[model samples]
Target: MSQADNLIQRLFSRRAGSLLPLVLLGVLTGIIASLVMMSFLFLLNATLGGLNGKNLEDFEALTWHWQLGLPLAGSLLLILLYRLTPPACQSVGLAYVLERLQFGQGRIPAANIGFQFVAALIALGSGHSVGREGPTVHLGAGIASQIGQLSGRPPSQLRLLLGCGTAAAISAAFNTPLAGVLFAMEVVLMEYSLLGFAPIIAAAITASALTNGLLGTHAILEPVSLSLASYRELPGLLLTGLWVGLLAALFQRLVLVFIRLPLTSRAVRLLLAGAITGGLALVTPQILGSGYDTINLALSDGLPWPLLLGILAAKLLATAAAIGLGVPGGQIAPTLMLGVCAGSVAGALLPGASDPALYALLGMAAMMSAVLHAPLAAIATVLELSLSAEAMLPAMVVVLGANLLCQHGFHLPSLVITQLRVRGQELQTHPLRTALAQRYLSELADMSLVEWSGEGAPPRSKATALVVKRDQHYYLLNPAQLEQRMAPDTLDALLTPERRLQRLERDMSLLDALRTLQDDTGAGFLVPVRRGRGLVTRARLVHMLTEEGGLY
Candidate 1:
């Protein structure tokens, strides 16, 4: 092998050696992702400002006719874009990224990235009730995937790179570094390790610093100082969690309903969704965009209860229609808006609440936690956004309550996981199974204990297994069983179809390897190490699982 090839092999031969390279790659990924996100935000804001003469989110400032016409035109444009693009290149957003990571080895097509950029620009700028974070995530992960492909990293390491990019994107989007790391762990990667944490944290910190330096902390919700009125408000916090959990469940169900609509034509769906959003916009322009401005108003208690309720209903319906119809925007912004409205309503109705702003902040965390099924990340996001230590206790209580209600009461999973299931990609959520899936087969392969030779006399040692090489194939044999059965002269006679061996790449996961074993009646699998092919037996796997605290 060439020296360069040898070095590449050494770097990624095991998971540990890949960490430094991943960390270095993560720095580059963060910078690139942050820059791309900044450019997208700038272009989107410029386009919206040029059209409406206000901030990108200030769709309410536009005239009634403009508010009604913008979404209709934008939706038609989206339909045209989809019609022009190939179906394979049309998938975008968090669900797409997760699907790719799970099955595509973190390889995102460049065409999809281009499509997402253009589609998101049209959807967000034209006053569609969606956030830009989803597109940003696609962009970041796509860039990282391209980098991994260029570097020729194995799929195992490439997945880590994808997580780094995802973290960077979230950090850049909100300038919440710690929240970004937690989100990547809880939502994107779905598994965590010290090795993975280092790179992801590096990526998030770098991305947050870079974006803050360039854009000066591009947070949508304005910071507010908040505190609980008293211990008496604890019950109110619990009720708020229950209320927001119900709202979150409703929102997720509505989005799923929209996603599973019977209409086969993409154009018809887009048009119908646009018409709904536009009709709603005519009634309440505050629902026309991401609704960040309205969220701010609700947070500061600037809007009355009636207006808050109206904005909440309109925004919820519009966002659900837009996303369900497959608009290329994010659900985060809409969820935040929903939380604000829910909390505002709670504060007005509940007597023990100290301030509406406090409830709004807690409700925001709770709704996000319940809908995304990411309590720690949601709590971190709220603490970072508010910069208030005093809000942590209330935030934790509300987030826990909301999560419990969603999981037990409604039997809801995270929105992304739900969408993935709808698309026929059921992810493994068991802790042991997920942990095993993250580990490579090479990690468990026992090379020193096995002897490799032809199908002849046994090796002069206490070897547990024997590998017989014939022609270009390798077969595994149990020494004790071989002694009981008597010597077989030819390899072909000994290795029957059921005893035939399967070849496993060094990067294939242990869980996947186990699954392969269950599906096929092979003697065992052969894993290629630097020295030679390593044999992994079913007995070995069972032992490992037992040691790891039983099968999942």
Candidate 2:
């Protein structure tokens, strides 16, 4: 290896638990993730600049014929691309990232990233009613995963870097570092710890700083001050939460319906996805693209209730079909629009609220929280974008209400989870597994051990494990068991089915080890360590999680 490569590998191995290496890794990840995200944003803007200057998402400027043709052309192109591309590379999105993290040990192919770049650019620039955030997630996580794989990091650390990239992407996209961190934890990692927070926070800050420096200063959503008038508005806020939850559930259901449809032909699905988006754009041009313009209008009171309602319905259908069928764009932007429209309509129906804008903001939070099932991240996003500390209580109320209704009332999980489950990929984020994943199994392995000849047993078992080699593989046993295994015809029975542990070539995170541990309940995993083979047992893992709360 090159000198720097060797140095990095050495640092990674030596200080795997240190914060300094992680902080530096986070910064580097942020820089690359932000630069890549900006590249996509720049291309998207330049591509769409002809249709709408300064405002990238304004499909209203397009004539009806252009609006009708753009999405269809884009869809045709995507269909062609999908047909030619390998099936493994076609899966791209935040849900894909989650799936890889849980099942694939954070390994993402580079081809998928390339596919996402092209697909998302075409889908978003062509006014497909999808957002950029979903594409951003795919790009960011894919890039980070590739980097970790190249660096020769283990599964656990690779997972950490992947999350760092995800956080950086969001921070760069929105200039909301806190929201990015929260989103990474709540939606991406689905766990929180000091080990994760430090690097992720650093990555988010770096990403936000770089994007702000390069893209020039502008708000994704303008900061609007809002205040609650009286106790009377509380009921309406709760009702708005319920309304947004219903809308969120409907959006998910519509997407699922399109997904489950019997349109087996890829060409037909892509064609209809594009045709539906274009047809919606024909009547309500504002529904095209991410619909940021529509959101701004709702926040500014520019859209009348009837027009807003029409736009909302059209946008919902367009987004569900576009994203559900095959488009590679994001869901967050469209979700925000849905929330804003739903909130605005609710505000108009129920007077005595402070302003429709406040409701708009609340709707954004509630819809996001409910749809993504990320209440904390959604609340953080709105708070950071709006810069209204006073909105916290109401945002929380609406977010929690929406989440409860969407999850319990409708029996739905997060959209990403639902998608993966449909594809037979279960994202196991059990609290115990999550906790175990954070720890290095090698560190907890019994490293101090003695090797025993097949003929005899060791002297003692005090703070030292006993290992025996048979069939060129090492297995762990105590002195007494070693003696028992030396008897005639006893080795095969003991080694094969009774107390044999699987051997690992190197140290792995407890999460990966635990996954491999499910096959046999006899013993744990064995890894080659410095002195001798290090043994990691499943019982030890459970004990660590339940009893060693204060130890780490």
Candidate 3:
């Protein structure tokens, strides 16, 4: 078939594929993920509750034997699971999303997910100070990919739906819909467009609805009503946010340090982490199971400074050790513990503070923002959890401050650092080469080969090319073109003087590039080498931009 016919067929096929079906699929994926995660969480909580041999709200003590055995046995199970799984599958959820989006749809190996689920259960049930959200995120996305592959969807769309499932998992886990949607868009997809938004939003909403239905309709954070003594206390909460940001940065750094440790045996590292968590649990049982109860106590003024500080230190070490040991788990809940402790201490120290619960809530946002380097997601989480406009302003201030500090000071994002470590990538001051490569050629090189008309000699009118915008107004090649031809020793041989050159800015979006191509005739025209740099012949230019040619 002719090129014209091929182009027409492809375009028509894309146009005919309805968006509604994808949206519905997203919703379905979200609902299913929500149900699955909720059921898992329920079972975990019920099992843990049964093991506790007492109520959840009360400060009940377990026998020394039980205390030591729970985390130890759980840790052993996690270590065994880690030992069995491959190194590439060690990175749990966020890494999976990033890889699938930037790379392509590939199975995460069924065994990996099974091991993760089992390990997460052991971690949470034994009180390893980890969250269930991370495992569920992997579970949702993995399941969605499997479904898509079975149903024969395109790899690209299937990966997109996988992101939708990830969003659903997070939303259901936290019961915070907006945060889940933003997380999927900002961190997972890394692109904000109408194409992705519809599916992601549908997924997030469906997840939230299903979770609320099962779990009895409660906000995620669920903070107590604080009776404000005075307006003067507001500044202290803001100050608390600053401290929380620093703590978040510290936590991120610690995780990076542990992950970077040169341990030859992954099994040994995991066993060591197991020992650490098991030992810590014996002293302070509160550090186990995501430490949600401990977080509540800290926020509610149940513990003094010394005890809170000890719990903070123990939890930090336990969490970092567990994740770095290569066991599958989420950092989100651990971060919540860090923030709660930080904010609680700040609230305790301040003079005549209105309410520390307010500060503790703000601290969560700040800490998470710093760790994730995603202020928008953190802020959305704060709003969804708090359900208060008054809370939004304070959350925004701390989250922004925390994110800025993390970017400037820490120099490592939590999830990305973990991913890089698992992949054995060197941590350097510069960005990854793959990320840099995407921007260089992909923005400009599209259908560039068709423009190459290998005629013996160019016609007079066609020889001196004309570059035009929409409606066909000619653009000039600037003096650089002339200089290249005049200089004998220069790289002028690489120049395509026979073709018209058009100026393209470095920051032009892909959509804009596509629109420009639609208006131009023949093969695609050349884009400028840089901002304000004029274009060259499409044939040589395309070759230069790509890896196939030596120029790259």
* Candidate 1: worst-modelled 10 consecutive residues by lDDT: 483-492
Instruction: Give the Cα lDDT of each candidate.
Output: 0.81, 0.81, 0.63
Listed per candidate, the RMSD to the true structure in angstroms reads: 4.6, 3.9, 10.1
Clashing pairs in 2: none
Better of 2 and 3 by TM-score: 2
Model 3 error, position 220 (Å): 5.4
Which lDDT tens digits does candidate 3 get at residues 1-552? 667555533432322144766787788789888887887777777777777654442213777666656666776776677667776666565565555544443345555566666767777777665777678778878766665554445444665677788788888888877888887766655555566788888998899888888787754455555444566766665677667777776676677677788887866776677677777877776676677767666656557877777877887788878776666677777887777777667767887645766666677777777776667887787667656556676677667667766677656565655566568653322333333322323233332121222222212242344233322322323222333223332322423333234444443323334445456543334554322333444454445446442221
Q: Any residue pairs clashing in model 3, and if so which? A: 127-288, 127-289
Model 2 residue 76 distance off true place after TM-score fit, in angstroms = 1.4
Cα RMSD (Å) between model 1 and the true structure? Answer: 4.6
Pitting candidate 1 against candidate 3, the one with the higher lDDT is 1
Per-residue lDDT over 1-552 for candidate 2, one digit per residue giving the tens place of the 0 to 100 score: 688777776765534466777778888889999999889878888998877887777778878998999999999889888988999999888888888887677889999999999999888888888888888888888878887776666567778888898999988888888988888888888888788899899899999999999887657787778867776888788988998999999999999998998988988998999899888888999888887777876777556778879988998999889877878888998999999888888888887848778888899999989989888899888888878888888888788778888999999988989888888877766887665655466556666666655665345666556666677756666655456325646755555544566777766767677666676655777776555667776677677656744224
lDDT string, candidate 1, 1-552, tens digits: 678656655654344455677887889889989998888888988998898676657777788888888998998899889989999999999889988877676789989989999999999988888887788788888988887766666566778888888889888988888988888888888877677898888889999999998778677678888899798889889999999999999999899889999998888888888889989988888887777778777777567878888888888888888888888898887888889888888888898748888888888899889988989988998888777668999999999889989999889989989988988888778987766665566545677546555534566557777776666666776666655334555445776656566776544777787788778877767777556767667777778667743322
Model 3 steric clash total:
2
lDDT of 2 at 39: 90
